[model samples]
Target: MDRTARILQDLYDSEINFTIATFWHAGFQIKLGLGDEVNGFDATGTADNLVDAVEWLRVQAIKKYPESVFATNYRR
Candidate 1:
């Protein structure tokens, strides 16, 4: 599967309850929705690979919504 699809599958498998899932190789942007809304990391970023992209999401989840229980089982 593609990057975005694969990522979404990971979220679904974990029951993350995210409504938004976007990733782009161009600057490696990522946007995720959870906990009823989104407030931070709502922009594009640069990632060297899938691993970096996943890490970015995790970090952003912590930064934007630290109280949330965000987890991604996707491995690069």
Candidate 2:
């Protein structure tokens, strides 16, 4: 799979909900939605590459779910 697909799979495996959009000249836009509607935290960021996008998502996930395994076991 491509890097972006791999990144998305990792997020799925980690039980993180996300959406990624690509723009011709603007790189990638990543949005991660965590938890339920009423108490959820949503994080959005733009990156020039998939790796950075996932890293940003990881940081946000950790911030919202400090006790989650995602904090320690997230893959690069």
Candidate 3:
């Protein structure tokens, strides 16, 4: 697979949403998210919005990583 696909797959495996910025010849940025259940990112970029997806992911992550620190940051 390519770099973008690999990165996306990794995010999916981790069950975390991500904000990725892609650059073009002029270095443009495009952010994308992977998870539907977790507000993996604080930015406005979202891949999909399944009902109760964010809540479900939050519960799962809380159970899986009790001591982990996870939050969404929307500052650019």
Candidate 4:
């Protein structure tokens, strides 16, 4: 598969739940949601590339849930 497909597959396989939207002529936006039903948080990141967008969202997720499995596994 191509790089974009691979990255998307990896994201889908991860525990983190997210949605991505593409702008007409701007770029891309990703909205990532973390935490359980009782406690939840949402973060949005926009970038010209998917990698940058995911990285931005990942940083936000790590900051909010430093001890979470997603953060721990992401570091490795």
Best by lDDT: 2
| Residue 6 lDDT (model 2) | 61
What candidate 4 gets wrong by more than 4 Å, as runs, is 1-14, 35-41
TM-scores, each model vs. reference: 0.45, 0.66, 0.29, 0.62
Candidate 1 on 1-76: residue-level lDDT in tens?
9665665566555454443344554545455544444554343455766667666665654555554434323322
- Model 1 residue 59 lDDT score: 61
Candidate 2 lDDT by residue in tens digits, 1-76: 9755665676678787876679888988877776544665477789997688877777777776666666566533
What residue pairs clash in candidate 3, if any at all? Answer: 37-53, 37-54
After superposing candidate 2, which stretches have Cα over 4 Å from the reference? 1-7, 35-41
lDDT, ranked from best to worst: 2, 4, 1, 3
Ten contiguous residues minimizing lDDT sum, candidate 3: 67-76
lDDT of 2 at 9: 74
Query: Which has the higher lDDT value, candidate number 1 or candidate number 2?
Result: 2
lDDT of each: 0.52, 0.71, 0.39, 0.66
Clashing residue pairs, backbone N/CA/C < 3 A, model 1: none
The TM-score of predicted model 1 comes to 0.45
Tens-digit per-residue lDDT, 1-76, candidate 3: 8544543454456555534333344332323334333544333332233323333344444444444443221111
What lDDT is obtained when candidate 3 is compared to the true structure?
0.39
Report the number of the highest-TM-score candidate. Answer: 2
